[model samples]
Target: MLHCPRTVARTIVYSGIFLATGVSTVLAADPTGDWKVADGVANIRVAQCSGNMWGVVAWEKTPGGKDKNNPDTAKQSRPTLGMPILIDMKKKPGVDAWEGEVYNAKDGQLYSSTIKPVGADQLEIQGCVLGFLCGGETWTRVGPPIPSSPSNSMAKGAPKAAPGAPPKTAAPAAPPKTTGAVNPAPAPKAAPGQKQAAGQPADIGDICLLPDIARFAH
Candidate 1:
């Protein structure tokens, strides 16, 4: 997610300290939300999917950008939107930070990375090449933190239709059996800013259900 070159030797000193101090924070800090990158070139939407943290490109300052620099020839023409930048980050035991690999689309390389929340509004990202040559930047929160989705909810709730295919219609359900007791009415939709009840699926358009993330969610 960081566009800065990893060859900068000066960043190692500060980044080393940053990574070290990040471990002191208490656990249970949530990082799910939209974040504005340091350079303001793009915003990433982070969410919990299949019990791990993943971030995808949600918005770009300049539209219609392609992943031209990607190493995979077949994917070079693909649009950058919705691409996963944070690759399956898992929470570090007893710490608030996540450890994973970050895909640097600018250079078509993946680096070992860690993301840590700095207070409630800032996210610190650091990446290292060969376990050194570290560099990072802080991303500011763009919206309120999202409540963590139930584990694997995104995958389970993901639409079954293939991309560009027409959606399938479900058959109508049979009439309920006649009984003295009446069936309870369905639960009301969760109001905005309210936490969803446990086991409830996320919205169909949730970023965690995107193909790039959904395929790896399980």
Candidate 2:
């Protein structure tokens, strides 16, 4: 092959551009780590799973939390610690954004969600039940990552589910008993499918701050 000077120079320029683009893409779109949410009241571990990403609750401020608000009657028995909050996130090509579903423990609803990094250290996680009625929280990358909290063992072993198995939905807690210690944040009266504000709870302020309530109010 006859190497022309002009052709060689053009090839070098193109190769440099391609390398730079690849490097930037690699650096920009990874969200693998422990993320502090709810004003550091809760933390989740995000990791790659089945060609996507999932986040599970590693810790909560409130001890031995339960998902008292879940809609699934059967799931109310599970503890809130190992519940999957951020589900099946797929990265948007050429951007620092991911699309996923966010499970809100407050109302037991899963909203369409997106996670976008505002800078190197912070991520903006927004979820929307409807376009106008949406809210988000800022998550800070806490550290490289810690071992899955002892409480989160249910979701720690496998990154992805088995083939043909149903996807793992958010774990729910058992139905509340008439113990009088039912400390769930009250969901305000709304029409069907109308969700409460991202962080604000309903009218129940009498209860103490349990893990359930601490992460609800914005």
**Who wins the TM-score comparison?**
1
lDDT of 1: 0.72
| lDDT by residue (tens digit), candidate 1, 1-218 | 35455545558877888876774343226677777899988777777777778887766656567899998999899887778899889999988899999999899889999999988788999999999999999999875565553434544556565879985574597533211111222333445765544533222236665778767774
TM-score of 2: 0.55
Residue 117 error, candidate 1, Å: 0.2
Question: What does candidate 2's lDDT look like per residue over 125-200, in tens digits?
Answer: 9999877589999898764422222222223244545789996675597532211122333232445765444443
In lDDT terms, how accurate is model 2? 0.61
Quote the lDDT for 142 in model 1. 72
Which stretch of 10 consecutive residues in model 2 shows the poorest summed lDDT? Answer: 201-210
**Pairs clashing within candidate 2:** 62-211, 75-172, 75-173, 76-173, 76-174, 77-173, 77-174, 186-202, 199-217, 199-218
Q: Deviation in angstroms for 109 in model 2?
A: 0.7
| C-alpha local distance difference test of each model | 0.72, 0.61
